[model samples]
Every structure is written in structure tokens, then in C-alpha cells.
Target: MQLPIDFQPGWAPADIEDASAHRFLFLQGALVVLRDGDGARLPDAAYRDLPIGVLHSVGVLDGRACHMAELSDAELPEGLEAVPLRQLFNRLPEALLAVAGRAQQLLDFARSHRFCGACGHANELFDEGRARRCPACGQVAYPRLAPAMMALIKRDGPNGRELLLAHGARFPGVIYSALAGFVEPSESVEDCLHREVFEEVGLRVKNLRYFGSQCWPFPHSLMIAFVADWASGEIVADPAEILDAAWFHIDALPPLPHQITIARRLINATIAEVAPDHPALSVYGAG
Candidate 1:
């Protein structure tokens, strides 16, 4: 599924020549500053006087030049509040939320790559690109993205098509989502998917169909989602990874992840395709 945000990513110049027509995103750690108003909105040109450190361009957002900057422990001015990125998930438009995630990732990349690993020398930002170069060892560090896979397994049952949902040990409350795992070295996404499904639930799956991908910016993960058919074996939840695993009928699913997650999208799309007449389609199948 395509995100609603319209962003054109490009390299940022060393210095912004003009700040009047630009939109600034000020971040303190994982917290982004939003103007106190009717709704959550980034600080506009009026607040440009705030302290800025190591500014990075986050491309254009809705025809406006967007930039990101890290802030020190400076006190926020009146009429502005620093809000955590997680709290702004559904509060902001999907497009703005996505751009905010991108800004956060870029800020994180810049903060963690200040020094080189190979050599103990301090690194310098490239003049024309988004990378840090170690003059001593010629080591270049760019933004890091860990590719992970999300699989929504399904099977034919007496009731109808059943979805294999599992409650992850790390999930909040009783929320259940599709099985997911990070890709290892020299392993393709499909291979990782198969391994993750079996390792987590001890179930073999087949008929892998690619669904979509999302940039999950919780410390930086590119989630590739898929729909797979259960091939063999019964549910065997790994105590270390999964709290519970079970097959639920399409119309009788339990509480799922939030709409911002790709897992929710994958599940909704599969249900819409396999069970078009499902009563929940009108509410949850738009993904």
C-alpha cells in the first residue's frame, strides 16, 4: 500500500540560504516539537529562532522544503511542546507522520555515526551526500536499515479461511500480530520468512505472496510484509518468542495491532480478498 505522504528525497546543501519558505522539524532525542494549537503541527517560520544543531534536509513535504535538526537541552519556548514520536502516530495525518519518522531516522543516523568504528578518528559529514567519512580509514557510514519480514499465514478451515495470529512476547497487552524476524547475512527475504514462521510457531508455510513494505522507524527497520498459506504442522508457540499462537476465523479476530502498522494492513487486505463479504470489511479492509 502506498503511503499518503508526497515526499521527494534529495541531498541537502551545507547551509540553507533562505529559511523563510522552509518548514523546520526540531527534534530532541525521539521527541519532536509541535506547535500548541488546534491539532499537532510542526513549528512554522515563527519559531525559527530556536537553537539548531547539525541541520539535515528531509526533502520536500507537500511542496514545502522540510528540514530536520537536533536540539540540545535548551528549554522549549511558550506555545510549543516536545512530544514523543509514538504519541503522534494516529494524531497526525499519515503523510506527516511518515515524514516525521523519516526525520527521526536521519537524526538518529547522524548522532550514532559521529565517530568511526574501524579507526578511532572522528568522522565528518560528506559535502554532497548523507554519509559520514573517516579521514583516517576512509570508512563511510550511511543510514542503517535492518530489513525484517512480516508474514500473515492463513489456511482453509471448517469455518472459512483462518488467519494465524500470534501474541509476541514483546507486544503490549494482548495485542497479536503476524510473525516477523530480521534477515540474517546471505539470506533472502523469502528464506527469512520461512525460517521465522517455523521457528516462532513450528508451522510450515507455502504459497508465499508478497504484500508490501513499510519503513518502521522504531530504531530503524524496513518491514517487508507477505501473505502465506499454512503448509503443515500444528501450532507450537516458542515460549521465548511468542506468548500465544492460534488460528482465528476472519470475522472473529481478536484485537489487532494499530492501523499504522503494516501487520494490520496485511491482515485487512488478505481478508478483503479472501472473504469479501466479511462484515468487518467496511471498517478495516481499506488497507
Candidate 2:
């Protein structure tokens, strides 16, 4: 459960944060603590007093809100569960956690949806409640996920093996990600993947292997990732989205993201570079 570079593992003890759309355990009051990236300890006292909400799940422990598993593997350290947040998503039987996670996502959406686009009336949660509504403009607002793409480009390795990968143009140094982009209007997921690959790397692909999916809440995103083979063309990094593109030996890969994301898990596993798993759910608050 190693978290990506920009991940922060934060949980609102059931008592500390209120779980909307129905109460969730993550919101219950408990002494939760975290040892962030800087190796600093974040005590429960630091956040216990904030207004009951889900924003605590955001990246505050460090530069980014990483998954809790990024912190440790041991469960119940000194009476606190030292675990990763993924376990919540992967382990929990229901979308209760996902609901909370989504609530955290929508919690954010609601903040931004407060303003009215047409009549300029403040929005309120109503419609039995459909979610949110504007008092003046009669505009109903709801949580949304921006459709995005995730693809793996294929090429022939020096040894005759296939090399596939996706790269984002805005990555750090020497870092390329899986091919992904926002699914445009009137286009299928596969269509967007094809167009994005061509537009970004100038390569067409086939046999799009559907791996899995994850609901990314960075301002709301639904990440649909796939594993595709080389259809035709050469490597060309689309300046609009792809910073640079290349093929790896499939065995020797570059820096990859954490298992919390489908984008990372898909490509890494495709190349058999599966990242290690860490513990889920960590408790750091005091007695």
C-alpha cells in the first residue's frame, strides 16, 4: 500500500468528522495520529477541534494526502490501528468507506458548488434532497467525476519482449505515466484512449485490456485504465499531455506511483513490477 508521491493518509475518527449520506465509522471519534513524510508526528490534538467534516482526508500530514498504508504496516500501535487507507477501500465489504471517501470528495464539491451560475442564489441541499440546490437560481448541483483516460503503450523491447506504458506530460523528471486523458464529449472510453495515444505519442494500439477502476477524488476524477498492444506507429510524446514517451524492457521500469491508484497498479503489474503492500488504517491520536 505504498502511497504515491502526492498522497496524504488522513481519517476523521467517527466522532471527529461527520459522515454524510449516512454515518460511517471513519468519522467516529478516536485518537488518530500520523507520522508524516518529514518524519514528524501528527498528534490527535492538532485536528480534534475542527468543525465535523471530511476535509481531514485531504493531504495535510505532508505536502500531499497520502494513503494511510504509506505510513506503516502494523495494526493497533499502542492501541491504535496503524494501517493504510486502501484497506478501507479494498477491505471494507461495502462502499461505506467509499461512501465516506466519496463524501470526502463531494464534501469538497459542495464547497465549490455554493455559488449559482445563473441567478446568483446560494445553493442548499434539498430535493428530498437531490444533493444541493440554489435558492435564487433554482440550480441543482451535485458531485461529479471528470472522465479521464489511462493507457499502456506497447513496443518491441531490445530482447523481443513487448514494452507498454502511459505518460503524463506534467510529470516530474524522467517520469512518464500511463496514457490517459479526459474522455471528450460523444466518444467512447476506447475511442478516447485511441485518440489520446495518437494525439500524445503518435502511436495507435489494439487489444485494450481492461484491468480495473478507481474513483480519484482530486477535484473528482474517474480513472479508467487499460493495457493495450502496439497497433502501429512510433513513439511521439504529445506536447499537449505527454511530456515524453518511450518503451521499457517491461522488466526494467522507472519510478512508478503507489498501489493506491489503478494507473500505477495497472502498468506496474503489466510489467511485473508489482509494488509492495502496506498496512491499512492507522490510529495515532492519544489516550
Candidate 3:
């Protein structure tokens, strides 16, 4: 996938104490950001006038300090508007979008872990690492990430190769995408994929190949993606979680998730593998 932003894994502050015009991503909540031109813009001097505290430095992007803040009951500055992170996908470059997601996740980690769960004492931010330390109990809290699995199942049908897709209970009407679920405490990623496939659609899948991964920071989730082949069982949508389930031909599909998602990546990759010449692959800029 072509990523737009150049992001590094670890945090490296350009200047830890610099108080210049630092770039800011003011998140209205966890999922939305203060929209700027084509991406999130830094809060202007007027915004800096607000009692915004010490900017929690997340990382250096292209040799600049990128920070994020959460605002509550504060009026936004003129010419700036709050936009949902999902919507930002269409407006911002992929790399910037990914960076925004990273910033938001770290900001959330800072906000949610202000107090230690194990000990009632407040937590302190470690200067060198992205961790919150508790003074009383010596418990260290790191950024929380929930691991989820996504499976794009394929099977040969009467006519040709087909891909399995499902509509989640959260989706409206006929919209469908890859089958996914969160990993439980004791289960492995493979185990979770199998169990989720069986439970959601009453189907078994095999040849679980790791396709790719994406950071879905809808409240901090690491989406582990896989492509699998249908092994057994019939289509039986679980009423509680799945609205419907079916195997679709490569040429025909419902309105899918956005292009930037790992679900779309798995779908497009599978279609390219099974039917490279299929016209639907054109949507993903494939032959």
C-alpha cells in the first residue's frame, strides 16, 4: 500500500522544550480532529492562548514536533471545524491519516490513564517513553491496544472462485465487508479467526495467511488481517452479530468499506489473485 506520511515507530522529539509554533492536532473527542487544509492544521496563536497545558510530544514528523490535545466544552477557533477521523481519510493523505491515528491513540492513552487502576494515586508521564508511572504502587501503564482479527475467506463455487463477505449488526442495509472480531484473553490470533468465522457465519476457514495489518485507532485497535479459504459449514448468519452472509463473485459486490481500510486491502488483493483481469479490480487501481 502507498502510504502518504513518513512515520517512525518510536517517539523522537526534535526539541523537548521548544515552545515555538508547534503543530497541533486538536481532537474534539477521540475519533474527530480539527480539520485543516487537506489535513489537520496546527492550532493558531489564538488557540494557543487558551489554557492548553504542556503539549504532550508524541513524535517527530518530517523533522517537526507533532502533538495532540483533547478539548472539552471549548469553542473552536474560526475557520476550523471538527471532522471525524473516518471522514479525514478522504481529505488527508494516507501517511498523514496514519500519523493522525497514531497521535490520537497516544493522546487517548494519556487521557485515560491519568490515574492508575491498580493504585488510587495519579500517574506521571515518563519523559523518555510513552508510559504513565504510578508513584504509590510503581505500576507502569503503557498505551493500550486491543488486537482484532479480520478474515477474508475465499472458496471455489459452481461457476468460479468466490469471496465470502458479511454484514455486521452495526452496519445498515446490505453493506458488507470482511468478517472480523476481537481476540480473547487466552486465544491465539489463528484461534480467534477460526472461532469468529464459525460463530459469525457458521463456517470454517483454512489456509489462514497473514495478508497485512493496520492501526485502526477507533479507540486504539490493532487490526491483524488474514486471507483464508473456505473449509466447511454453510452460511448461517448469527442473528446477534451478523445481519447477513454470502459468497460474492469477483465482478459483483456491495458498497464496501473505504479504500484505506485493511478490509478493502484484503478484498482487492484476493480479487487480484483469483481474477486479475476482472473489471472490478479497477476500483482499486489494479489491472
Candidate 4:
């Protein structure tokens, strides 16, 4: 996905040091408030008043230095609220949203890898890119992104093509989305796709055409999406992971993921392909 603003991606501190203005995303425990409740707000001056401290450099936004930091309860000023990271998706612009996700992953990396696994020594950010290095043992740790596969299965029906959508046990209400599962160790993404589909819905898929990718920063996941033709198998919703599964034509579909997500993009692309003149395809257009 393209960012709304130009962001010169880098991890080196020197890259952002010369920037004229600085914007920061602050995380209190695990949330950052994008807006205030009663329409009031916390200005950048709030952060500027805090004592001098090191800021994690995210990237330059329109020639200004954009940074992030993990804060404690006492660090937050009055009238500010901390919301879950996921809530910022629709609140911030596309470019700033991307930066927020990056900050989330970076903070996760920093918190988990504070000490070197090999030498048990405190780890520090490397001078250049995003990495943590140990002075004692020379060990380096980079941000870890778990790769996951999402498959949107489609099949030829008596009326027209239908998409196989499922509701996971985690979701509330009747929300349905493409089947997804984490890529196992030593397993290819395609292999993970087939295994997850068969295990979750007891189906076989073919003609796996790679669709696209998205960085889902709920925790840390790289979503690799694909459009696959449902080859065979009865719809069997695995009680463990899937709550329900069904095939729905584009004209009669269920609730889908957000427009910023790859699952929604895959569905939209498939709808456009099956029914070029369908109006639903344009309903959930890009953000």
C-alpha cells in the first residue's frame, strides 16, 4: 500500500537529526490516543515539555523528524487518553498509520529483546538500521514479523463464482473474512495456505495466484494474501478455529474486513473479476 506522505525509510539516528520539526507517537503501556474524547486535544508541546530523552526514530515525514517512544503512566500529561493501537487505523492518515504500525513493531522488539539471549547483556539499538546489538557478545536482534497466509477461495457455481468466507471464533457477531493461518517453521507460505485451508474447512485449493501483502501490526504479522480456486471438499468448519463457513456470491455477500486490509482488497479484486459491473465492488473502495 502507498503512503499518503513521502517517508524516507531509515533507522539511523543521523537520518532524522537534522529535521526541522519533530512529531512523535507516544505509547502508554500499549496505546496511543489519536484524538481526545470531548473534541479537545493534546498538543505537541506536551511531549516537548518532557525531560530530554532518547526517541526511537521512525522516519522523516515531509522533511520533519517523526519519532516514537514507550511511556509510563506518570509520563502522560493531563487530558490525554491512551487507546489500543488498532484503533488508530481509521483515525490517522494512511502514511501516519503506517508509521504508527512501524512504531508498534519497533517497541515490541525493544521490549522483548531488551537483553541479549546469548550473553544476557543489555541490548542497544544499532547505529544504522533497525536492530538491537549486545556489546558483550556482539549479538544482534532485528524486528521479527511472523509471516501468515490468507487465502480467498473461489469456485464456479450454478449461478456464478462464489467466495468461500468464514467467521473465526475470535470475531464477534456475523463478521466473515478470508481464512488465514500462521506460516509454520520450515514451511513455505503456499504449504501453510493449503494446510490451513484443509485443516480449518476441510477443503482443497488450486491455482494459487499471489494477490498482495499487508503489514498487520495488531501484534506483528505480515499477511501474504492469495486468490485460490476451490478445487474440492465439503464445507466443514473446524470447531476449534472456524465458527462458520459458507460460499456466497458477490451479489449476496456478508460483512467483510476493513478497506485498509488485504483481506478486503482480495475480496474486492475477486468481485471485480467475477462481476465486472457489480456495484458492491465499488462500495468498499480504497481508503
Q: Which one is best on lDDT?
A: 1
Q: List runs of model 4 lying over 4 Å from the truth.
A: 1-5, 14-22, 34-43, 50-53, 74-79, 127-129
- Residue lDDT tens for model 1, 1-287: 13344678756762454554344455555555565455677766667677777667777766777777877656888767777777776566677777777778887887788899888799987756688999999999889999999999998888788999999998878998899999999999999999999999999999999999999888799999999999999999999999999998987888888887889988888888877677876666456
Higher-lDDT candidate among 1 and 4? 1
lDDT of 4 by residue, 1-287 (tens): 34444787767563324434444545554544536553322236445544434567777778766677666434656555566655555655666667767777877787899899998999877857578899999998888989999999999879988999999998757889999999998999999999999999999999999998888886889999999998998999999999989999887989888787888888988888867778887776733
**Residue pair clashes in candidate 1:** none
Model 2, span 73-92: residue lDDT tens: 22333423323334343343
Which consecutive 10 residues in model 3 have the weakest lDDT in total?
A: 14-23
lDDT of all predictions: 0.80, 0.53, 0.75, 0.77
Taking all chains together, each candidate's TM-score versus the true structure is 0.91, 0.62, 0.87, 0.88
Regions of model 1 farther than 4 Å from truth? 1-5, 14-27, 35-38
lDDT of 3 by residue, 1-287 (tens): 23235554455543434545344455465333446656664444455554454456666566555665565545656666667667666776666667777777787787789899996799987757678899899999899889999999998878887889888998745678999999999999999999999999999888999998888888788899999999999999999999878898877787787787888878988888867787887775441
Q: Tell me each candidate's RMSD, in Å, in order.
A: 2.3, 11.1, 3.0, 2.9
Global Cα lDDT for candidate 2: 0.53
Clash tally, candidates in order: 0, 42, 2, 0
Ranking by lDDT: 1, 4, 3, 2
